[model samples]
Target: MALKDKQTEKNKHFIASLEFALQGIRTVFKEERNMRTHSLMGVLAIIAGFIFRLTTVEWLWLLFVIFFVLIIEIINTAFENVVDMCTDFHFHPIGKKIKDMAAGAVLITACFSLIVGSIIFLPKIWQLFVTYFL
Candidate 1:
């Protein structure tokens, strides 16, 4: 009976964690403009991948990049917000550097995603051009 109760409590904790995660997702979608933009870009990327008839592996790679960039952007935004909330315009150099570094991380992820997309799609695009024009 004690084991059963412990298992039930664990299940309840898992549910609560899920609820918290859902609330965070809602907050991001509702409060963060960049989150919305990233979501829109993700949708567009999925549509384009389908329209371009990407192979399963290609689609997987594209989706992986897209999700990675968006996740990093969200983390960067969260860090910036936390830093801003902690210091309200005190001109703290460390805080500024931390925020800048977070933004740089997002930028690096975005650039890498772009490179991955190009690597995955450029050959297919070139082949299509040759097939259509030559």
Candidate 2:
């Protein structure tokens, strides 16, 4: 669960920070189609985990995979937005390269997430198939 700040005057800055961070999440979900796809994937992963009756340790690792991928995806969105904001008319090679690298980062995270999901889910799914269909 996400940590919550105490509702006190002393915690105003912390509360505001949390709000800003949440706004980033909202922005990404609204503006990035890839973010929506990631959300769908996360939901499906959780549902599959429930179906497979994942161990606590496996669940924890899956949760880490979910959060890490989402975080990198958000960072990728932020990087692209910042690049667009900085460049106006014509494209700069450096900006293009930077944007490409940011996209590559997201792609790398996605590939890693897929590998982890396969490692965690594939054997369970295979067993289910063998037990019922094979």
Candidate 3:
């Protein structure tokens, strides 16, 4: 009986935790410009995937890279917020380095995502252009 009660409590906690996570996502999307940009790119990717009729493997790769980029961006945003809080929004060399490093991480992930998108979309786009124009 005690074990069952514990399980029930855990289930309730999990649902509440999910709500908190969703709220965090909403907050980030609302407040973070980069997150909004990434989200727009992700939406475009999904639309292109449907238009191009991507294969299962290609879809998997597309989804993976999109989420990976978003995840990294979210982490970068979180890191920036924490650093700002810690530094009280003052300029410190270490704080600048921290923010720069976090930004670099987002840049690297964005570049990687762009490369993946090109690899997946360029061929299809070229084919479509040739089909229509030539």
**Per-residue accuracy of model 2 over 26-94 as CA lDDT, tens digit each:** 999999999999989999999999989999989998998898889998998888888888887358888
Distance from true location, Cα of 108 in model 2, Å: 0.9
Q: TM-score of the candidate numbered 2?
A: 0.89
In what order do the candidates fall by lDDT, top score first?
3, 2, 1
After superposition, the stretches of candidate 2 with alpha carbons farther than 4 Å from their true spots are 1-9
Distance from true location, Cα of 77 in model 1, Å: 1.7
Deviation in Å, model 1, residue 83 alpha carbon: 0.6
Any runs in candidate 3 off by more than 4 Å, and if so which?
1-8
Cα RMSD to native, each candidate?
3.9, 6.0, 3.5
Distance from true location, Cα of 85 in model 1, Å: 2.2
Per-residue lDDT tens digits of candidate 1, residues 1-134? 67665555778799999999888788878987877887887788788788789898988888998999878877887888788888885768899999899989988987888798788777878889999999
Clashes of each: 0, 0, 0
Please, what is the TM-score per model? 0.82, 0.89, 0.91
**Over the full model, what C-alpha lDDT does candidate 1 score relative to the true structure?**
0.84
User: Poorest 10 consecutive residues of model 1 by lDDT?
Assistant: 1-10
Candidates arranged by TM-score, highest first: 3, 2, 1
Which wins on TM-score, candidate 1 or candidate 3? 3
